[model samples]
Target chain A: MNHAWNVTRMHLRYNSIWLYMPLIVLFSSFFINLIIAVLSDVPIYTGGVASVYLFMLITGLLTLRNTFSFAIGFSFRRKDYFFGTFLMVAFVSFSTTVLLALLSYVENNLTNAWGNELYFFHLPYLNDGNVVIQACVIFSLMFHLYYLGFSISSVHRRFGRYGMMILLIVSLVAGSLISAIITYFHWWQIIFTKVIAYSAFQLSWGIGLLTIFFILVSYFMLRRATS
Target chain B: MGQILEINGLTKAYKDVTSIYQMSFTLKENKIYGLLGRNGAGKTTLMHMITAQLFPTCGDVKVFGEEPYENTRVLQQICFIKESQAYPEYFQISDVFATAKSIYPNWNDGLANQLTQDFQLPLNRRIKELSRGMLSSVGIVVGLASRAPLTIFDEPYLGLDAVARGIFYDRLIEDYAEYPRTVILSTHLIDEVSQLLEHVLIIERGELLFYEDAESLRSRIYSVSGSSEVVETYMKGKEVIHVEKIGSLVTVTLLGKKEENNKKQAESLGLEYVPISLQKFVVDLTTKSREKVVKGQ
Candidate 1:
C-alpha cells in the first residue's frame, strides 16, 4: 500500500499530458465558441463543451500506453500500478468535473453566458436540477467515459494485438446486432422516453454504476498484464 | 552467503515455439554472473522470469525465497534493465531519475547524478528524441543507480560505444565494491565483459548448457595443433568439440580443463597447446550444439 503511492507519484510526473493539455484544450474550445457567439445575432446553444469530455476519454487510453509497460518493468507490482492509476484518474475526474460544474453555474446564474448568451456549459438536460446534482451529472459522465477508454486499453495490454483485434470485431458485431434488434422492435422511442424522463440526479447514478464496472474490469485486466 | 535466486525446471512456450525449456539453476548472494548466449538462446526469457515480468509455463522462480509475481517484497528488490526497455513518450531523463528514486528502496541519487555526467546524458531531452546509444546509456545509469538487491542487465548496452561502455563497467565495479549485491548481466558480448564476470551461465536453444565459475569455464576447453597424424592420435578417447585441418597440420579443440597429461601428450607429439578465448569457447560450444541439432534432423 505504501509503495502504491510511489506509483501514483510516478504517473503524476507527466503533468503536461494529465493537467496542462486538458485545460488548454477546454479553454481553447471555449474561446472559439465565445467568439462565434458574440458575432452572431441569435443566442448560441452549441455543444462545444463535448470536446473537453472527449479529450478526457482519450487521456484514459493514452495513460496506459505511456506508463503501464514502463512501470511494470521498473520493479512495481501490477496491483500497485492499478491502484495508483485509479487514484490518479479518480482524483483528476472529480476535480475536472467540479470545475466544469462551477463553469456551468457561472454561465447560467452569474454572467448569463458572459453576456453573449453563449450556452456552452449549462446545457438543457445536463445542467438540470440543483447545483450538487448538476455536478454529479458531469462527474458521472466524465468518470464513465474515462474508465471506458481505460478498460479498453487494459484489454489491449493484457492481451496481445490479435486478442485486441478479435475483441474489437466482437464488440462491433454485438453493438450492431443490439441496434438492429432495437430498431426492429421500435424500442428507441420507448427507451428514450423512459431515459429522458429521469432527472439529472437519477441519470448520474446510472452512469456512476457503469463507471464502477469499467474500473473493476480495468483493474483485473491490468493486474495480469505483462511488460 | 545465502541464495539470491532459485529456478527449477522453468519453461516458457508459445503457440509453436518454446523460449525456455526445463532450465534450472541457483545463484548465490553478492556475486556477478554473466548470462551468455546467442541472440535466440533464451537469455532474455530467463531474465524476464527472474524479474517476474513473464510467467514460467512449467516451473517456478523464487527470488529471496518468495514468488516475485505481484510480491512487492520481492519485486521491489529486483531491478531488470532489458535491451528493449520502454519509456513514456513524454518522459525526460530527469523524470526517469525521479521515478527511479521513488520506486527503488536503495536508490543512490549521488551515483545517478555522477553517471548522468559520466554518460553525458542530456537530462532535459525527451527519451524519444535521444539517439539509440543515448537511450542505452539511460538504462545503464538507472540500472547502476537503482542498486536493487538483484540487478539484472539484459544486453543493456546495445548501441553504446566502447568508451561509454567502459564508463559503465568502471562505475559498476566501483559501486559494486562499495555495496556488495547480486548482479546478473546478460549479453552476447562475452569478450568485453568476460573479465568482470565471476560466475557464468550459458543458455543455448532454451536449455542451460553450462553453469560454473568463470575460471573453470575458461579452462574447460583448449586446442592442440601439429602433424595431422600426431594430433589425431592425441585426440583419441578424448572429448573433441571441434576439429580443423590445413595442409599437413591438424587442430582439435577438446573439452578438459588444462590437465597435466593432456599438455604432456601434446608436447611429446611435437604438438602445441593453443589457449582458446572465452568468446571462441562459447561460439564453439553453441555452434557444436547447433550442428548436432542439424545432423539429428
Candidate 2:
C-alpha cells in the first residue's frame, strides 16, 4: 500500500472524530448564535455566518495542538504522517466552511421572510469554486497547530494538559498587566491597543507561516524518535 | 558458521545510567539463539538497538553487514515482537495483518489467517478492545506470518496461558523447521525453550557473560557430589564454579568435560554425579559470582 494512503485511511477509519469536529464547533456556534438572536431580536443570518470563522478558529486551535501525536505516533514514516494529516485536516476544514456557507444562505432568506429567525447565509471563509485550495489553506493552518503541539508535547509530553493551562494563565496575566500599564500611561494607549490587536492577528497568521518551518523541525524530532 | 549480525562494543546509555554496556556478539544465520537474562539486564534494550528503534551511545551494530537504521532493505527482513505490542486503538486484527503485509516484503496472508484461526483471534474487534492474551496472540501472529529472516520474540508469552504458549512453541518449531530462518528467543522461561535453542547467550548487568552452543554448554561444567573431602579432592586443580557443603556431604560444580571413566572414578571414590539441566546451568552461569565482580570492578 502507498504509505501515505495507508496512514490517511487509518486516520479516517479510527479518527472519524476529527471529521465530525466541525459539527461540534458548528453546533456550539449555533447555540451561541441562537442565544444572541433571541436576545437582540435580530435574524440569525449575519451573526451565524460570522460565528463560522469563530468556530473554525476554536477548532483550528484544538486541531493544531493534537496534530503531532496523532500524525507520527506509530511506526509510519514521518513524511507520510505529515501528508496524511495535511489531507485529513484540509478535507475537514473545507467541508465545514461549505456547509456553513450553504446554511447561511438559507438563513438570510428565512430572516427576510420571518423578521427574526435562526437560518444560514454564506460564511465569509468560502471561496467561489475553489474548494480544493481553500481546503489546502485550512490544512496548512491546522498543520501549523500540529507543529506547535508536537514540538511542545515533545519537550514535555505532559505539556498538552496542565502545561498548556499554565501557559495560558501566565500569558493572560502578562497581557492583563501590560494592558493596565498601557491604559494608565494614556500617551500610547491607542497605538498600544492597535499594536496588541495587530500582534494577536499576526500571531494567528504567523501560525500558518511557522507550520512549514516546524514541519522540518518535526521531521528531525521524528527521525530522533525512530532511532 | 557465517555471521548474519555482528555487534562491536555496542553501548546504549540514558543520561547517567547505562542500559547496555560495551557488549559484542555474533548471530549466525539459520539458528535459534536464546537471549537469556534477568529483568533489567538490557535484553529489551539490546533488541531495540538491533532493530534500529534505539541509537547506541557508542560502538556499532551490523545486520547482514550493513547498518540497520532506516535501511528498508535490512528492516524488511527483520521482525521484532515486543512483549506488549501497541496497536492503534481502533485498528482491527485484520488491519494489523494488512499493515504487516504492506510493510514486510515476505508477509504471508495465508500464514497469518492460519495463525489467527489457530490462536482463535477475532478479526473484527479493535485492538484496544481485545483482551491481553488476544493482544499477545496478535503479536505472535504478526511475528510468525511476517516470515522475516531474523525474527526476535521478546517475552511474547506474557499474557498467554500455558496451553496457548505451548501451542506457540509447537507452531514456532514446526514453522522454523520448514522455513530455516534465524530466530532469537528472549524469555525468562528457560526450561520451556531449552530444547528449541541451538545456541544460548547469557547476559548479566548489561554485559555479555557467555555465548556458546547449547548442546556443548552443558559439557563446559559438571557437578560432583560426595563427602566434603572426596568432592574437594575431585575438584582439585579444576575451576570450581560453585561448592555447597552439607555436614560431611558436599556438592561441587567443576568447569570441565567428564571423561569416559570420570563417572567410574567418582563411584570408586564414593562420589555421586548428576547432569545439570540447561535451566540450572544458565541460572548458575548468569547469577553466581558475577554480581560481586561487577560490584568490585
Candidate 3:
C-alpha cells in the first residue's frame, strides 16, 4: 500500500500539468466571457465552459498511455499502477468539482453572472440544486468521462492500436444495433420521457455507477497489459 | 551466500512464438552474473520475468524465497535498467532522480549526485531533450544509486561513447564491491564485460546453452590451427564446435580443457593452440547452432 501511494505521488509529480489544465481552461474561458460581456450590451451565455471537463477527460487517456509503461518499467505491479491511477483521478476530479462549485457560487451570488447575466459556471439543469448536489453532478460527470478515457487507454495498452480500432468499431456497431431495436420497438419516446423525469442527482448517480463499471473493466485490461 | 533468485522450468510464449522455454538457474547473492546471448536469445525475456514486468507462460520465479509477481516485498529489492526505459515527457533529470529516491528504500542521494557529475548529466534537462547517450547515463545513475539488492541492466549503454561506458563499468564495479549485492549484466558486447563477471549464463534459441563459472568456461573451450590434415587428425574424437579452413590451413574450436599431453601432442604435430576469447566462443557456438538448424531444415 505504501508503494502504491508512492506510485501515486510519482504520477502527481510527473503529470501535474494535467491536474492544473482544467483550472487554466476554466479561468481562460471566464476571462473570455468577461471580455465579450464588456464589449456587447447583450447577455452572454458561457455554458461552453464545460470544455474544462473535456480536458479532464483527455487527461485520463494521456496518463494511462504515458505513465503505465513507465511505472511497469520501475517494477510497479499492475494492480498498484491501477490503484494509484485511480487515486490520482479521484483526487483531481474532486478538486475540480470543488473549484467549479465555488466558481459557480461566486458567479450566482457575488458577481451576479459577471454583472452581465453570463452563465459560465452555472448551467440550467446542471446547477439547479444545492451546493452538494451541484458538486455531485460535476464530480459524477467528470468521473464518468475520465473512466471512459481510462477504459479506452487500457484497451489500447493491452491490445495495441489495432485492438483499439476494433473496439471502437464494435462499440459503434453495437450502438447502432441497439438504436435500431429501439426504433423498431417504438421505445424512443418512452426512454426520453424516463430520462427527462429523472432528477439531476439521480441521473448523476447512475453515471457514477457507469464509472465504477468502466473502472472494473479497465482493471481487467490492465492486468494483461505488458510494458 | 544464499540464493537471491531461483527459476524452475520458466517459459514465456507469445501466441505461437516461445521467447523462453523451460529455463532454470540459481543466482547466488553478492556476485556479478553475465547473461550472454544473441538477439532473440531470451535474455531480455528472462530478465523481465524475474523483475515481474512480464508473466511467464509456465514456470516459477522466486526472488528472496517468494514469487516476485505483484509482490512489492520482492520487487522493491530489484532495480531493472533497460535501453528503452521511458520517462514522462515533462520530467527533467532531477525529477527522475527525486522520484527514484522516493520509490527505492535504499536510494543514495549523495551517490546519485556523484554519478551525475561523473557522467556529466545535466539535472535540469528535460528527458525528451536529452541525447540517447545522456539518457543511458541517467539509467546508469539510477541503477547504481538505487542500490537495490538485485540490479539488472539490459543493454543499458546504448548510444554511449566508450568513455561513458567505462565510467559506468568503473562505478558499477566499485559500488558493487562496497555494497555486495547481486548484479545481472546482459549485453551483446561480451568481451568488454568478461572480466567483471564471476558466473556466466549463456542462452541460445530460447534454451539454456551453458551456465558455469566464467573461469571454468574460459578453460573449457580452445582453438587449434595447423595443416588441414594434421588439425583434422588431432581434433578427431573431440567435441568440435567450429571448423574453418583457408587453403591448406585449418582452425578448429573444441570443447574441453587443454590437457598437458594434448598441448605436447599439438606441438609435436606442428599445430598452434590458441585460447579462445569468450566473445569469439559464443559467436562461434551460436553460428554453428544456426548452421545446424538450417541444414536440418
True contacts kept of each: 0.85, 0.11, 0.69
TM-score of chain B of 2: 0.91
lDDT of each: 0.88, 0.70, 0.88
Output the worst ten-in-a-row residue range by lDDT, candidate 2 chain B: B254-263
Candidate 2: tens digits of C-alpha lDDT, residues A1-227: 26667666666664555566546656777777667767786545544444444544454344423433333322345456546655665666556656644444444444542345655343333322344444444444544654565554443333336655776788799999988887898847678666566533344466667866665654565555532
Weakest 10 consecutive residues, lDDT, candidate 3 chain B? Answer: B257-266
TM-score (all chains, Cα) for each model = 0.97, 0.79, 0.97
Model 1 misplaced regions, further than 4 Å: B257-261
Give per-residue CA lDDT, model 3, range B84-118, as digits (tens).
Answer: 89888888999888878877789999999999999
What interface RMSD do all candidates show, one decimal each? Answer: 0.8, 4.5, 1.2
Q: Which ten residues in a row have the lowest lDDT in candidate 1 chain B?
A: B257-266
The DockQ value obtained for model 3 is: 0.75
Tens-digit lDDT track of model 2 for B104-210? 77788888888999999989988879888998898899889888899999998788999999989988988889888899999989889988999999887899977
| Selected candidate, larger lDDT, 2 vs 3 | 3
The runs of at least 3 residues in candidate 3 whose Cα sits more than 4 Å from the true structure, single-residue gaps closed, are B258-262
User: Which 10-residue window in model 2 chain A sums to the lowest lDDT?
Assistant: A66-75
As for DockQ, the candidate ahead, 1 or 3, is 1
* Residue A73 lDDT (model 1): 81
